[model samples]
Target chain A: MNESEKTRRKTRWFMLGAFVVAGAAFALIAATSMSKNLVYYWTPVDLYRAGNKAYGATIRLGGMVTPGSIKKLGGTAVEFDVHDATQHVHVKTSSVPPQMFRANIGVVVEGTMLRDGYFQSSRLMVSHNNEYKAPAKGHPVDQKTLRKMMESTEGIKD
Target chain B: MKTAWIFVVLGVAFLVAGSYLGLFVAPAEEYMGNVQRIMYVHVPTAWNWMLAVLYAFGAAIAFLFTANAKWDARLEAGLEVSTLLAFLLCCQGSIWAKPTWGVWWDWDPRLTSVAVLLFASIGIIALRGFVDDPHRRAVWSAVATIIASVDLPIVYYSVKWWNSLHQQQSSPQTVSSQFHLPLRLNAFGVLFLMIGFIMLRTRVANMNRARETALPPMTEHAGEIA
Candidate 1:
């Protein structure tokens, strides 16, 4: 083969080698980081299953607020029980809850589960299911009520 | 070129209108309150940057197939804009995240994927400068961009695929209509601005190519090589 052809063949091989090395490095980085950080919202049941592992580790607990579980504290602090049918957890937070925060709605709280058996939440988020509705034509509707109406009104006109 | 100015004017106008609606007209969000207004810009930037990256990815493929200089130019324009918007997205996300999440940043899946995407695009840009020969540079950069574009889907699906600090994707059904107007306005505003920038920037890339073509190839270092 001529000198130019030989040089071009070597360049192609080098390019392929570089591409493989880069791809491997990227995959390694992504896999390690993902394994370390992927924290799915855990149900109370998951927490129960987790046992000692759940304690002191930062977590996202998700479930419905039990009826009448809310206890108001001085200056925007509140404590409540979050439950999912079979399992339950006590949640405590100093930050004011969202306007739509109340009993029976699904809420996700992010914090650490203390060894004392309380979830000390630093952040709270309301989880709404996928549904849309035009504004209530007549009376103002509460968001929760709107969600209920949405569930029933599925397949019905807007 | 004259029409590009029109795009700029329209883009700026929509951006101003969107900001006005977000700041004064729209009611404060129930949960996040005033801080949610940042979404007007943040979401739009995120959308536009993805759009820009997709265009770059497409152009990169086209350049590979056709060996067209224009496609390479378009690819460069898209990469530059994508990088800028990715930076903006991170900044806006950080600001919004702080008050809401109680932290400035998290190594959550969604955030991490976006960081990776930004680094990939930046790497492609740097790759273009590292290679000397124009033909080789274009070919290798195009190949690199195509590979980097794989991260785009990973970024988009990161929240859904794994648990994340960021919320799931918001759609018309998911987002309340009350919050829709400014979001739509800002989305279009960024779209127009991105198009305008890419059009103007493509011309700049073309001029650069012309200058490069005029220069004697490798002449500056020929004596040293001898």
Candidate 2:
């Protein structure tokens, strides 16, 4: 082969080696740091696990809104119990919840754990699941009845 | 080119059918009601956007190995199409988020990773434009694309690995059977449209490259003088 061809071949090999090395380094960094850094919200279980650290510090706590636990305490203030499988946290928020907020739906509330034992949230956001279920046959589709139907589906896993 | 047109026609037909089913025929969701219908377009766009990124990554690898201009053309096409779809995905997600999540956007892992890759692809495309030499542009962009594509797996697994506000992926197993037809239809619709866009874009890139390599009249005169 000519000198130019030899140099071209060498360059290709160099490029390949660089890519492999860089990729490996990236993988190492990402694998170590991703889990700790990428968490968008903590669960009620996570909050409990944190214990003393959980109180007074602002953090986002995500869980399902417990059925029959949502209460409108006059005006925009509302209270609900956010629960995972084994643990639950009472949440009080002054912010208006999203229209989609309903019983048994996933939610992420951002605020601090109060000394009084309830989560005081300034912002409340709903976290909808991936499952999309059509209303049952002959079920009323109005907003009021639809909400009631959703409430009734609580604790019933599909 | 003809094949691309055929794909376009098929894509449009599927989209029309899918949208009809999603809007009028499908039953309202139990919780979100009519707002949930946004998934018909949003999810499909997201799925197809990932496919477009994969296509670009493959093209980038092939070009580096073979140094073929055709692969470069295909890579450009894939990058542009991926960007378009990514933009669409974000817009649709935002519209869906406003009513459902109470926020138009959030810094969740899944959403953040997607936004990162979108901006990365755009930067790579910009890199292609600044470099004047065709071969250098191709090589640099190919390398950039490969690097950017490392994020693809991260984007896919972000929801699974992290406490994301975004939900897990939906599939036939997770979704109700009644919602299947429209979802599948739109998925195929977006897939075909993406394919069609890439094919046409590839032709355009090839033509541009050809023009760039073509000898100018001034160059011919200079050669004679030399």
Candidate 3:
């Protein structure tokens, strides 16, 4: 091979070497982050074992908002208990609970760790189940539900 | 040499000062409270990644037009540094997302585009390195950067165009009139930090290239692998 061919070969190999290096870096990073999500998103078991350091630190709490535990105090203020199988947590907030946050369903709360050791949520999401529905065909729209949803949209900019 | 040192010192000092300003001085946001402090890391990281991509684009264009090896070297440096910075950005953003969005990752516009940008840029740089002809490498990577950069605005507005959990980025003066000056200073500090990183990274690329050019032909030492 000529001198140019040889150099080109080296450049190609060098680039290959770089990809090998970067791919490994990306894999390592991905694994670490996934592990952290599992480890740091404290479960009821983990939190109880360590006296709930998980509370009061910003976290995403996921559990079932217990059935009878939900109470409407006044206006938008609703209080409920979020429960895993083992331990349960008290949640206080004043906003519309997501449509999916039905009795004994999964919910995730995001926010800071309060001094009182509660997951003082700044954001809440009711888990959307990975369920599939058949495509709507001839079913007529429910007029009453449509009217109710329209009425609710008057004040919400979002 | 003196200019390099000046940047290094400034980078360190501004990093320290900016940390203090964002962490200590800025009042806790009324809603998110101290969890909002994560913004200091997230915003800067995202900003730095953007700047790094810009640097790569500028270097690529320069190399294409000037046909100078130095511009090629600069383009290589920008890509390397930007890739690492993009890695950091993904990490820090994951941390921030958990506190705000209740998930480590989301498949939304800002995020989806950034991922595409990172992967596409990596591909461009890889293609550049694979081609032995210096001119070809420069031209191809330059074209790649321009194409990749076109997606940046699309990524920036992704959240707005879609009904996404990611909130609208707060304008500087929107929070308080007092935030304007401090935020600008903070942005300036981020710019300086990026400049320093890019310069350092580019020097490394130059050294690697020099090493490649200076080495004797393969036949001269036929058995040895560099």
TM-score of each: 0.74, 0.87, 0.57
Q: Compute DockQ for each candidate against the true complex.
A: 0.16, 0.41, 0.04
**Model 3 TM-score relative to the real fold:** 0.57
lDDT of 2 by residue, B1-226 (tens): 9999999889999999999999999988877889999999998999999999999988987777777789999999999999999999999999999899998998888899899999999999999989877777888888888878878888888777676778877778667788889989999999998899999999999999898789575643554675
Q: State the displacement of the C-alpha of residue A65, model 1, in Å, after optimal TM-score superposition.
A: 5.9
Candidate 2: residue A157 Cα off by (Å): 14
The numbered model that scores best in DockQ is: 2
Model 1 error, position A93 (Å): 6.8
lDDT of 3 by residue, B1-226 (tens): 4565677778667767766876777766543456555566566767777888888877765665555678878888788777777777788777766654456776544677688888887898789768764556766676666656655665576544432334445555234443333445556666676777677777777887777667767643554565
The regions of model 3 sitting more than 4 angstroms off are A1-158, B177-182, B216-226
Q: Rank the candidates by DockQ, best first.
A: 2, 1, 3
Q: For this target, which candidate reaches the highest TM-score against the unseen true structure?
A: 2
Give the runs in model 2 whose Cα sits over 4 Å from its true position: A2-11, A14-18, A33-37, A138-158, B215-226
Residue B226 accuracy (lDDT) in model 1: 72
Q: Which wins on TM-score, candidate 1 or candidate 3?
A: 1
RMSD, each candidate, Å? Answer: 5.9, 4.9, 14.5
Candidate 3 docking: what grade?
A: incorrect
The candidate with the higher TM-score, 2 or 3, is 2
Cα deviation at B35, candidate 1, in Å, is 2.3
| Residue B133, candidate 3: C-alpha displacement in angstroms | 4.0
After TM-score superposition, the amount by which residue B225's alpha carbon in candidate 1 deviates from its true location, in angstroms, is 4.7
